[model samples]
Target: MTKRQKRMAAVLLLLAGLSVAAVLGFTAFSKNMMYFQTPSDIAGGKLPEGARIRLGGLVEKGSVQRGEGLVVNFSVADCDANLPVRYEGILPDLFREGQGVVAMGHMDGKTFVADEVLAKHDENYMPPELAEKLTTPDGKHSCAQFKSMGGST
Candidate 1:
């Protein structure tokens, strides 16, 4: 090939390689990304279909129920709705009712089948994602926000 043609071909090949790399990078990022949402958002059908998500909210009082073995069922509630969650493993030490939590998993029909559950580690600590969503108009975090909307403690 002529020198000019060879250089053109080389440029085209480089562009093609870059395009492939970009596509692969975007695919990997999207596959690994997990979105955070509240129970109200889930109720409104804001969940991504078949994608793993993090559900963040207050654990509803009187909702924790232990099933056979390590499986446990509970509800996560926001101001407008409550989402049922099922987890089949040992829970975090801080997991309990009336506390902020973030559960990572995918929706199985109407319930959130959590592969992992993370609870607030202290009285003053709430997950940043959950805190941001639940912040009061006065800029204060309030679990009472859920309680007033027919959620438990």
Candidate 2:
């Protein structure tokens, strides 16, 4: 084969290898990409049943119920909609009623089968999955800040 032909062949082989690598990388990333949805979003039929997803909302007051075998049930709401979640594990220290939370799992009928749960520390804090929803319009803190005893605004 000519030198130019050999060079072209090498370039073609390199492109093919890169394409294969890209496909593999994309496949791996796609599996790890969990979609975030709120109760309202899911209620609107935007989510599919049994699909892996992240649900973010505030824990509803008086909706937490602890059961046997490390099972806990709670209701998550975004004011407009609410979803009941059943988690079978220890919860975070900050997990409480009326606090922001994000649960990762799949939907089973009307309830979310949570594999993991995260709770927001305070009004000024948000779970990593819900940070985008906490952005302010003026680029300031979207969450309510705690005031000092000295009457600082």
Candidate 3:
């Protein structure tokens, strides 16, 4: 082949290889990705069934229950809607009712089966993701509530 033709072939091969590498890299990274969502966002079936996601909201008052082993069940609410969560294993020290929290896991029917649970520490701390979702201008869960709790909006 002519030198110019050979060089063109090499360039095309390199571009193809790079494209494949990028696709594979993106696929691998996406497998570990977990999107954040609130109870209201998923209430209308906006979320894909059984997809991994970060469920964030306030722990509903009086919804906590301790079952066998390290299993604990509770509900997360954005004041307008609530998402039930079941978690197994030790919980964080700050976990409690009437508190903002984020759980990592997938949904099973109407319940979220969480493999990990995170609680906001300190009296003034709130997960930024959860805070943003709850900070609706006219919603019951407003930024004012965060301010009232001594948390920065």
Candidate 4:
């Protein structure tokens, strides 16, 4: 082959290798991606069956129940819905009702089985995603509105 043909073949081979690498990278990224969802999204049946996700919301008041050992059950609530979560582990020191929380887990039938639970570290802090869902029109966190949306007082 001519020198020009050799160069063209080399370029094509390089392009093919880059394309394959790109595909593999994207595939791995998609597989490892964990999406964030709110209680409303889960209540609307937007969760894919058995897919791991981060559920962010406020822990509803009067919904915490302690079971044997470290098992605890509570409801995570948004402005319009609530999702029950069951977790079997020591909770964070800051975890409590009426606080923002993000639980990492998957659904078990109608309930969320959490593998990890993260509570907001401070009284004023809320996750950006959860804040967006719970913020009122006046740009304030509205506990009254949350209660009106089906959350417990």
Residue 113, candidate 1: Cα error in Å is 0.3
Checking candidate 2 for backbone clashes, the offending pairs are none
Cα-based TM-score, every candidate: 0.58, 0.58, 0.58, 0.58
Ranking by lDDT: 4, 1, 2, 3
Task: Tell me the deviation in Å of residue 27 in model 2.
Answer: 23
- After superposition on all CA atoms, what RMSD does each candidate show versus the true structure? 10.0, 12.3, 10.4, 9.5
Give the Cα RMSD of candidate 1.
10.0
TM-score of model number 4: 0.58
| Candidate 3 clashes between residue pairs 3 or more apart in a chain or in different chains | none
What is the per-residue lDDT of model 1 for residues 1-153, given as tens digits with 9 covering 90 to 100?
999999999999999999999999977675234345677666766456778888878888788899999999998887667889999998888887777788999999988999998874435556799977865542124454432311211
Query: Could you tell me the TM-score of candidate 3?
Result: 0.58
lDDT, candidate 1, at 108? 91
| Candidate-wise lDDT, in order | 0.75, 0.73, 0.73, 0.75
In terms of lDDT, which candidate is strongest?
A: 4
How big is the positional error of residue 89 in model 2, measured in Å on the Cα after superposition? Answer: 0.4
For residue 38, what is the lDDT in candidate 4? 72
